[model samples]
Target: MLVYDVATRTVAAANKAAMRLYGYSREEFAGLPITELRPPEDRAPFLEDFDVLVSRDGPASGTRGVRRHIRKDGTRFSVEPTYHMMRYAGRRGCFVVVIDVTEKEHSRELLSRQADVDSLTSLPNRKRFNERLEQAIDDARRNNTGVALVFMDVDHFKDVNDSLGHGVGDRLLQEIASRLSSCVGPSDTVARYGGDEFVMVVLENGANSDSVAGGACQCDRQSEVIAHVMRVFAAPIAIDDTEFHVETSIGVACFPADGDDAETLLRRADLAMFRAKSNGRNGLQRFTPALGKQADERLSLSRRMRVALSNGEFRLEYQPQVDLQTHRVTGVEALLRWHDAEHGSVSPATFIPIAEENGLIAPIGEWVVQQACFQAQAWQESLPGLRMSVNLSPRQLARGDIVCVIQRALARAQLAPQLLEVEITEGALLNAGSAELLEALRAMNVDIAIDDFGTGYSSLSRLRRFRAERLKLDMSFVRGIGVHREDEVIARAILSLGHALGFSVVAEGVETDLQLAFLRRHGCDVVQGYRFARPMPAVDAYTFIHRFNAGSLVPS
Candidate 1:
């Protein structure tokens, strides 16, 4: 502790602890000015505060607070300073005591920095970003300014990590952080929103705000933000003597128009970012009302999908797969359909993705397996060699319990595993652990068929890794096959490839005689489309089977 005389502005005395801490002896502190103990930047503020406190509170009243003080070695540390007006040496002076609070202050600062900054890139983290967004919104509200939230994500960042290494990825993120900071103004806040995601909150005057009705940034300055980000990342980055080009998808949402709050703006911006990537990478998108409508519907669908099974909204229709050589029905693929009384018939393309995302696919897939197996036994008895093929969601095979589900269904229905072919999309096979799961299914004697082949950018070598028994060609390649040379070439190539792999090929969307003749000429084993038959109810299917077996079936 050190005692100083306020009237003479001199240190009166010092204790042993003060001498050791300040690297000064009691005699050395005998005539030192209080300003000498504080750093230059803090000296003026401390003196002003002390003068104000003494003048307002009178003589014996004390003032206490924390401040930085320089030691004799010129190193600065924080201290809890207190000044009491007291009588000393027969004159009015201040009794000053400063308690070292450096350690406590350092610990608090460390925790605060750790919470706000990303450990890898040293950029602001999501928590700090949220707080900054709230403050920005508050400022915008007061000043009639609008805030712009920009969401950014590195395109194919996973491929970069896989090809190079995590070390390179980390360096790339650091470089990205530097570039992001360079692109923004001092008033703007940049944050690491997620693993490969970065966000920016820009404060701008509403004089040039976006037009909410158009869902666009009509203001040139607002649109310039996207252009600036593109220009910053246009060049290739050199990492470890290697040059690599990276592209980013950016999305923008303006405040007081896109949303009134932070979370809504963030969500809208995220949706716009998805739209940017969907339109092709290395681009930008602004939040539109259509995106919000779709997002709302998706949320509703995701929530409702959980109870759709119990409500009996889900049903199956079977499309016949006719053997081209024999002109006989070899199998039928089970197609899922959903119809709600209030929302009406929802398209499979729309709701299937919702089901897969919400995890409703697993239970729904199990239900389909059981239903198909139960229907397959009776139909097999009627047609003698009919196979049951059910389409499985990509998530269905990801779950480890799939094989057990297949076993239980087959056992309960007494259906032969050979007659049950599980159809999976190439997208599902791209997921990790799917190959092992499919192999496990095959080990149990169930057949595996690749569904919607030629759609996903799947490698032929990777395709060979999975022991698939059949390839159901996607409908896109089959459409206008005889009309368009491009479709004809693609369809022919897929058919030839399937045969070369010793896998049976099925031509889908065969709606006309020309398509049927085209597949027949190509020696395609199966033809599945409208010309054969639309997916019919079980009772109608039984009736159709009776007619087909009797050699009197005609296209309806």
Candidate 2:
């Protein structure tokens, strides 16, 4: 090992091991300066520490322990740089020993990088995004600059998962990540924020920083980025020889404009993205106060709906369906009504679709069935021949559990299957072939009528396949029976087709005398309209049926 001389400031001598440790010839070690072992920038600090060591002890004492150093090749490795407070070449000096730690330091650096990088996309993850955002925020505050944070989400991404499968969904996400990376500059960053959402941060530059001192200016840039992103995402991305199209809706919230912090800005951007999807897909939106309020309202309404069934906030109204020939109350169709505690009497049109989408329709449907059957049993006890018809939504049909629900309701109500009619629209039956629940319902010998028959797409062949007992013509076909030739022809044809198939035909929404006369002429088995009775509660329906049977009814 070489000994370092403090008084003379020279390398006195070197052993073979010391010369090899520093990748130097013995002569080279003797000629080289001690400062050569340290980085140029660290040499000043090293020298200051050296002066303190020399004052406390001789150079040999300072070099007694290990010291870190770099080689002449500019490669760094830690060294003991040990020294002994003894005479070297008749001068007080120190002996140095070196040990290499290059591999260990390199490994630590690699692990640090791996922690920040995403394994799949190879882009940064949300963790790295947060850390980078903190630095960016500090920089923005110091330089008085602007930063934009964009939140982008894929539109109809669930469809990809549903139709193509999750494998394709994963591939699509990867391709999208690549395309997004291409759109942004090197100074900006794009991160996969989780799920199908991504976050991008772009800092303001040059003169733009002064004009837009807040991060929200990037909200305007959302349209530009979205246009490029959409064009890139719009074209099909292929997976396993199949090409799939993808689109996105972006929400933009600028730093300082939306919020200076990460959480607030991210939340706002998420809200704006949801707004874009709600307004219509394939678009971008900036966060707004009104949109936030609307989201809060919808969330409140959805929460209330979830508890509605449990709280017994629902009611059923029955509208009579009369037989024209017998002039008797053949059946009453059950309609659902909701009386919201906050927003009273919500319309079926408004909440029904929401219920279906949220998967709440199945339970709500069961309640309707049980209530309708119980009411029909009550009416049958009073009138002896009345039937109750309950409408089935498409969502309920898709689940294929309607038969089991009906069986349970009938058992609870102690009602005969014939007196309980389930009305399913044509749309519900369109995909009923593979539905075991529907097939089970057909096997039960319960009356299944195709309600609003002509309102949906149906074929003569498909109509024959359904286990239906009656066909109720939609109001549209019955609206202008005598006035419009097409309407008359369609109504008559539907009635004829129903009769030919051994099914009873009923004309719904028959409000006029002419429409009733026209249907009676066309051999319609039944007619239901405001002319007979509007949908009313059970008490009124009982009175209306009694009055009609007594021939004491007045024309409205």
Candidate 3:
């Protein structure tokens, strides 16, 4: 407890609690004015507030509440000090009651920080980051300060977790957080946005009032800040007593330039980050309106894909697979076509990756398998030896119960495993690894082929390890044959390797007589491309085979 002589600006009396709260003896407290307890920065504010409290001629009841006070040791503490209008020692003054809420305030602050922090990194989480970003944007708008939101993702993070244990991965993440913290200003915020991604909100204009007045200054300065922040990963990160080199791809979104709202800015920044990854990692990309437009297009395509698949707008077109020696149709490749209600024909390259990312491929893949199996079985009854091959994406290989699905489809269509072939890319086999799924498919006697080979890493290794029944050279390599000198040698080597490994070789994208003749000369077992025939409807395929058999249509 304490008493203040407002007119004289001196302490009237001090109690034990007041003395302890101020970290001073009663004699020392009595010698100093109550305002002395406030730090220099708060002293003037306290005096102004005290003058307002005294203008009423005495302390108002209940109107007085918590006021900040500084200790003799130059530490600040909050105190709920109430004053009463009373005549103390026959002088016009006020009676004061001081109760320290410093501990309570400290506890509340700790809880607030804990709520906004990530448990793993002890740094602010996305929730807190969002709050700060909104406030920063508001401030930037008002003062014309430069603000940048940087979205960054670690490169090869999956490999880190796969090659090293997750424990080491976690440690690496922590180390990255530390390095990121060291790269920002005191007022800036760096938050772990999810998994290996991080969001950094930087305020570049603090005292530069001119920068605030000029709306363009904020963006210009922010661009430079973003460039520096992105280069933070040029150095290697040492983790677990071993040095490992890694890079970060960053995307920058600026206020009043890219977007006005936090959500839009973050989304644009994320999309730009993906663009950075696509253009080869270890660089920073600024958000462009064109990238946003592409993102919108992708979203539109994805939504339409769901409708296309559900509305039965998809169909299988078969391209005849010819034998090199006999020139007879041995199989037909089942290619997917989409007649989108809104966008017309959507290419597989456009929707396939989107479907895979959104988990829509499993169902789409199953539908393809079932439909192709049914069609192949129908054709087999006529041709008696025609096989149908359908392509499977990596997502389908990773998630689908391929063995069970194929068995059920075969039983439903009454088609044998030998009559249907499943084509998967080298990427799929690399991810599929030496799993039980591959072995189970083999046990069922399903002929598996690696499609679009030589395009992805581990093609030769995967072909050998999976014992692929067939290998289809990608159109890129096949198109290069006879034009590029090296392509011919590589093509010949691939064919020899396939034959030596007891697998049949198929050349794809054969669009000319020269390519076809060259492929046949190289002992290629089969060829399928536009040169033979574009993928056609089931009825057209049957009619074409009939015409060829009748000698009306000659084999090119």
**Which candidate number has the best lDDT?**
1
Instruction: Check candidate 3 and list the clashing pairs.
Output: 37-70, 144-212
**Which runs of model 3 end up more than 4 angstroms from their true locations?**
1-107, 144-146, 203-219, 432-434, 459-461, 549-552
- Comparing 1 and 3 by lDDT, which wins? 1
Candidate 2: 10-residue stretch with minimal lDDT: 207-216
Worst 10 residues of 1 by lDDT: 207-216
TM-scores, all models, native as reference: 0.90, 0.67, 0.81
Q: Tell me which of candidates 2 and 3 scores higher on lDDT.
A: 3
* Candidate 1 runs further than 4 Å off: 6-9, 40-63, 82-97, 206-218
Candidate 3 per-residue C-alpha lDDT over 271-383 given as tens digits, one digit per residue, 9 for 90 to 100 = 99999998999788989999989999999988888887788888888888888888787888999888787888888888888898777888888898999999988877678
lDDT of 3 at 17: 76
C-alpha positional error of residue 253 in candidate 3 after TM-score superposition, expressed in Å: 2.6
Expressed as tens digits, the lDDT of each residue in 219-244 for candidate 2 is 35444555567677767888888886
lDDT of each residue in 233-332, candidate 1, tens digit only: 8888899898878799989999989999999999999999998997988788999999999989899877777667888778888888888777778788
TM-score of candidate 2 versus the correct structure, residues matched by position? 0.67
Off by over 4 Å in 2: 1-118, 126-152, 187-189, 199-219, 238-241, 250-272, 275-280, 283-288, 303-311, 322-328, 352-365, 383-387, 391-406, 417-434, 444-532, 546-555
- Poorest stretch of ten by lDDT in candidate 3: 207-216
Instruction: Using TM-score, rank the candidates from best to worst.
Output: 1, 3, 2
